[model samples]
Target: MTEALAVPRIASPEERITSIIALASSVDGVDIVVAAHEGFTYSVQALNPEYEIYADELAAASAVYLESSWQKLTGNARVILADQGGKALLVADVGEGFTVAILGERQAVESLLDPVRRLATGAPISCPNCSAVLDVHTYTCPSCGKRIPFTATLCPYCGTASPARSCPNCGAELMLAPGRVEPAKAEKQRSAVAVTPRAQSNEGEVVSEEKGETPLLIRLTIGGGVVAAYYASSLLLGIDPVIATIVGAAPLAASLGLILTEKRRQ
Candidate 1:
């Protein structure tokens, strides 16, 4: 047994990065974890199955760009938080050209700051809200009975206004107020009103055409009668009556044919 010596295997850079991401994914509510170095994506892990579709987006090199841009803007920012509707993004620069990103619910991502920093940098960072308890209480919509965030003033699922201004968990008074209208519904109503003028103008044009048709017909009939009377007077002046009758009826026949064709096409 002493003839052979054991050799320890060393993990590659990609493997090391993957292991870091795997550790980060152990936190509750964390959906995706991504690691990148020097503008190159090393690994992407989706912890939540429902969030697998967005994994490709997190693996892009743009994350590195975003980290650099944030550092430039803040002049020494190590961590960044961005809110994306129902979800949020947390990017931390763990030094040594290594950057880690986390995507999850807003409250979940906020709670992950200290743990993520400690795992990635071997040192913990201070966060003012890290010690505070996260708001995990959800409100039930009166209309749809769907559970929504405690801070939500309007139910996104049913567009109903929240009736309670107190915490559902501890029955404490909250500073939230009822929202007048849902933003999405208001935008849709504005768009519908914006197109109403165009639709009304189109209908007006149709009505004007319909009303003017009778006047046009009356004018054409009167012109044809006048032409017939003029030709009938020519017969008294010694012109052939049959020729005069044909000449007077020719204009009226052509007008009728044109009107019929237009109506058929319409």
Candidate 2:
């Protein structure tokens, strides 16, 4: 009777970044998948946690710092190589206000770039055959051995259509934006070294940033008025030279004091 009442499960729950990285770990050369944003690591998706703890730490800091810094400079980095020593560092746009840092064999790790990109855009990946979850590690589905990549537009084995999408990073129809042209690539073409940010130990080292505008035209007008008054007092008024000098200086002093007062109030 219990067997008669049983029904098959429809599919796995919705896909997510955590599960995505778990699958990516199975890829032959992918070593680490970290979810990072704004100079902090939210999840060390996959790692050894021993030898890579230092690299991971550096990667996390640079991921957040360099990406944000680059955005401030170029309005977008499209992607950034934050830090690298034994491991290559990358911060690719994952959209949704977050990014994924993949550190491993540069070529192999890059293979999954499309996957991270899909996630950022809110279109998660799943197997075409059985609707099983998938990641870069999943070039071929275990559920049915159906070839995948989603970029292919249709599963060669299953004939299932790939979901249509508007890239979170680059809104191109089918092609990825070759990725917002890595910043270093531009410099390399121009003979420059846009290398990793130096990892230094200096408690006294200071990093600072500032943005705003000053009332330049106003200040210039104030100064011009003061100069005109100085000349008017000495040449036009024809009062006692000493008295005119003192009186002319008064307006200049008063104007400056008013300017300072206005700034302080703001």
Candidate 3:
């Protein structure tokens, strides 16, 4: 009979971070660990039990870290790194920052990069507002104000009431408009329309988008007004019979353009 070999099991990133923290506490320096993904709040922690912080405070720290590294991280990715002579570890990321790294004696957490990277690649984030899958850095809704989390609800700056938590456009809080189920559904439909390809034979309803008044109409109206004014002035000056005809023609041309433009758009 062949002797069975014992297989070594790898520790998960969370486990590794915990282990590193324990060791760092017993030695010199502080350790920090962070983990963030879609639908998950950013977090920060100090390894030493003596270093206590409130949940809100930790969230603030994590948010700061995420904002600072926003430029460097990938979407739905995770990362883990250490500072303070391996005494601190920061696993920072939102969607793409789902990394778990340890900082300690270099020998204690060697070769952690590969595992952390793998974990990040395997785990993606879901949007908190709509539960749609999203990348780590996607703070704005891809469907709405193109802004997500920040603009759904009331305006953060103006303290205005909005329907959701983030804005659809600039990610500003939605205040002027109500975000009910119907509006949200419409927005979602619009986004779908943008991405979906159509087949010539597959009939679908063509939704009309609201647009500003036609430029032609504006021009025509302005032209007509100008002509009327000129004709009145000409009458006051006793100009020739041709002046009246030209004025009448201008108004007629303007009206025609207005009607045609409106009909074509409709």
Candidate 4:
């Protein structure tokens, strides 16, 4: 059997019946085939005498066979039927209340069944990323919009890399899809932006973030003022050390509070 087969669609009842016969004959080991109409009134059967089955009886039998076979397969545990002589029957859905009969030995018939099913059910290739049906010609997965090859370990669109269990670079237990946009990674990036002493462009204006280190002059000035005030209150004013410390901290706390109060952004 050929690798590719077209799934046929017919416009009319007559055309659908004709198509069933055409499809049946296309497969290997189809010694005799029949296409039964919706009713038992008319049927089209291949008039080959090599296989000894009456056409009228076959036409009637095929209709009943198609109906009963699928039910039996569903109901039974083994899901297959075989006669004592080793002759077997295999059935599959060809869609549209129509069935194509293939007459052959059990093994040969079974082999052709899956390939015919591929044609009838459409091409079976699927996207590993999204499970969407993939077009035979294109490597891009249409569903998730990933452009990676089918056998690739990672999906290029969604940062989903797999089968490794975890990321080597970050040691993240799960990197997830859609690249470094994952919540944990994104939060890390935000933290990086906040800490790094770099200027960022905000709508054509340069906005530089301040370095976390305090200025040397400001540190020296504040330290000198604190020591001088403490000594002056203790030695010159003749106040107790505890009293001087409390009094000194009162003004300093007020001044620091005034300076550190956050400005509201409008």
Best by lDDT: 1
List, residue by residue over 1-266, the lDDT tens digit for candidate 1: 22322211113434334434644565456788877676466667788878766655665633554545554222132666776547888776655566677888765576555444343443321112221111223455678775554445666555777644443323334444332212244445676878777899999999988885986597578769967896877778888877777777777777777777767876
User: What overall lDDT goes with each candidate model?
Assistant: 0.56, 0.47, 0.40, 0.42
Error of 2 at 93 (Å): 4.2
The lowest-lDDT stretch of 10 consecutive residues in candidate 4 is 73-82
* Model 1 / residue 166 / CA error / Å: 36
- Per-residue accuracy of model 2 over 99-173 as CA lDDT, tens digit each: 556676554455555555544343444333333323323444444554344333434345555434333222323
Each prediction's TM-score versus the true structure: 0.35, 0.37, 0.25, 0.31
lDDT of 4 by residue, 1-266 (tens): 43433323433434434543444444334455544444232444443455535445544555566556543221121112323124444443344454444455553344344333433344333323333322211123344553332223344444455422222222333223321213245555777879644344452242222321234335445755885689686977788878787766765565455445422221
Backbone clashes, each candidate: 0, 2, 35, 3
* lDDT by residue (tens digit), candidate 3, 93-202: 42432333334333223223333343344332222344322221213333332222221233222344445433222232322132122235555677677764564223
Off by over 4 Å in 4: 1-20, 39-47, 71-86, 90-97, 118-266
> Considering lDDT, where higher is better, how would the candidates rank from best to worst?
1, 2, 4, 3
Residue 65 error for model 4, in Å? Answer: 2.7
lDDT: the better of candidates 1 and 4: 1
